[model samples]
Target chain A: MEDPKSLSNEESLRIITQMIQTAKGNLKGSSFYFLLWGWVGTLGNLGHFLLIQFSDIEYPSAIWLITVPAWIISLLYGYRQSAKEKVRTYSDTLIAWLWMGFSVCAVILIFSGRFNELIPATILMIAGLATFMTGLILKYKPLVYGGSSFWIFSAMALHVEPVYGLLISAVAIVVGYLIPGYILRSTI
Target chain B: MIPDFKDLDPLLHSQLRLAIMSLLISVQSAEFVFIKEKTGATAGNLSVQIDKLMNAEYIEVTKSFKGKKPVTTCKITKKGIKAFEDYVNTLQGYIKK
Candidate 1:
């Protein structure tokens, strides 16, 4: 709108309504890292499982190293997103720190030297918590339900064979990450 | 025009400043570009009005770098919110009449 010396009350009210709506609309265009993390997570787990089950790769688990770059990408993406956003909501800050904590926890568990099913179980549990919290913050039902399903998959991971643990992770990532991710993408 | 509406905050009486304040009040803080985009104001024009609001202590302006690009963001202050609320209340009174 052009700058005007004087405006009627109705004109002033209209401008306020329009601008507030434009600000609110800006919050809806983000589903970037959800899709990123989901794809990387699902593919990484599947790759790990296939090598362990069908091939004699000396270190099938080494496939997880592929995610190392995803971490860098995630960080850089988050940094860029932060820079690009003109507004900062409370939920934005909370969700960013929440995933950050989840990343730290995952990193610690991966390096904890506990080569057992419990590692996957605990990791899934932590992942579930982060997903659930993010869903709550965003008020998205698909993610909320998907996050809840992670708990079920985590339990199943405990009873499966060690090689199947990789498969279970793949499934958990699919249900808990990819499904909600697709829905979020569609909504955006 | 009416006597009742005349009591509205003069700082927020103009269209662009009111729009800027409305946007800032909706979100915690907003950048200069975002404000300009939302309000449909020219950069120079928006900057002058923003400076008016800033000088009145109605909003806070922060200048920082988004990567190599310079960015300016603004947030409505407590005084600004009170003024906006008062303006709306006065307008409501005028309308109800």
Candidate 2:
């Protein structure tokens, strides 16, 4: 590292390539967020299904309240991650912004309160896009497939009754979110 | 033709400084400790090289407190990216010759 005056072009090229590779390879996947959302989404869907089918609940949709705690947990996890993450790679920044955009869009759709029947499809489509781009950036195939699975489920969800759609949504979270989330967690 | 070492950017010609620029260019930003670990440079040496880059406007260095602990982060500036690209193109010219 001292006085590389005698260093050859090949040596400089080697150093640049080696260091760039090191930086690119240093980023680990944020699997916790994915898994957390995956479980929460799955439960939210299944809870609605169970509450509606098994018990004569006054409001089955109220089961979606589970996301309240999930949001707090996600925030705490992100705070802890930012505290320890030494390198903020472009991929990380891009992914963070992508999800933030997704969240904003999702919130806008829900608050519009017009597409109540289309809510499940809308969520799946946005989730699919985010997951797909994330996989593309990270070059991870399982997540790429996971993202595609959401679209497939989205199509199926559209054709079913809202009650049946809940079950389909649960299965989608399992295949499209939870499975890939676990794979990402294990790989890291 | 033999390679013209004189044509190379002297700032980026050295081993450690070039390595630092190379690493910084690849990421959005990196912590001082992370750069040190990656470059395998000592803290004192790393600080000196970082200062040189900062003074040259080749990189931006920021210092802030993370709770009670101090943190330093480095990011390659636009000039740094341009210089690095030009250096690579120049090196490639020598190789192609």
Candidate 3:
């Protein structure tokens, strides 16, 4: 076998170009997943709005109903993608399980009438911690930093009035989801 | 007074090696294929460069099976990371006038 490291600069450059081409090809093949995620988010948001505004439902109650099916769908999507991506790491599986746990907690807290005041705050805190842990486990900087920010904001929001809680959630969605999603799309 | 390049040259200071070092600095571990794709190096070339780094004690390599296929993962050692930073600092000295 030829000494792989003994290539001239030009030969190395040629191989590097081929590697990049292969990566781009893989990205192109997976582009549909991006589109699917976008559609899922759009539908989730629409469902949220309908449940809150038109159905005469309480906000937390609305979230409970709306997020359950959304959570299921998203989990299914995640599982399928993880399998396809050959995510064999234990850390990846742990993150997936954590996400599912957060979703279940969110639904349960939303519907618990006796714990109405505490559940939202608890859910926010749990979600933030889960996101942060996911980011750390995956070693993805954006998620790590973004998730920590969410955790901080949610912790702070827990002390404030309900109205301010909504704003915190908005910021979490914007920074943690929207901004990062756009960045991912642009970079990859 | 600055020490000359002859006094302390980076052991794996080529462009591809530098690129590999930079990428490895950020992640816990990366697969050989990932590094090859990221650095745009051929498998053979990447394998060779990786071996050099491993020999220099800058990186640790693990060969494992991913289902039926063989996968090699590489991670920069603490010593390797410190060397990379030192190299960067030394390179900066030249341009800092």
List the candidates ranked by lDDT, beginning with the highest.
2, 1, 3
Question: For each candidate, what's the DockQ?
Answer: 0.58, 0.68, 0.07
Mind giving the per-residue lDDT tens digits that candidate 1 earns over A51-129? Answer: 8789998987787787888889878887777767878766777787898899899878878887444676788888899
Pairing residues by index, what is the TM-score of model 3? Answer: 0.52
Candidate lDDT (C-alpha), each:
0.81, 0.88, 0.60
Per-residue lDDT of candidate 3, residues A53-107 (tens digit)? 5687556344435445655766687666643452133454466578668767876
Give per-residue CA lDDT, model 2, range A1-188, as digits (tens).
34536778999999999999999943264688788999999999999889989999898878888888988998888888889888899988898899999989988997899988688777988899999998888888888999999999988998988778889989999998899888888877
- If ranked by DockQ, best first, what sequence of candidates would result? 2, 1, 3
True contacts kept of each: 0.80, 0.80, 0.03
Candidate 2 colliding pairs, count: 0
Q: Write the per-residue lDDT of candidate 2 for residues B1-97, one digit (tens) a residue.
A: 4555538898898888999999999999999999999999999889988998899999999998888999999999999999999999989988998
User: In candidate 3, which residue ranges exceed 4 Å CA deviation?
Assistant: A1-114, A117-188, B1-6
Q: What is the lDDT of residue B65 in candidate 1?
A: 86
Residue A145's lDDT in candidate 1: 86
Scored against the true structure, residue B55 in model 1 reaches a CA lDDT of 98
A121: Cα error in model 2, Å: 1.8
Q: Once superposed on the true structure, which residue ranges of model 2 sit more than 4 Å away at CA? A: A1-5, A25-29, B1-6
Residue by residue across B1-97, what tens digits does model 3's lDDT show?
A: 4446432244544667766666676555678877876777788877877888899899999988766888788888999988877765655564463
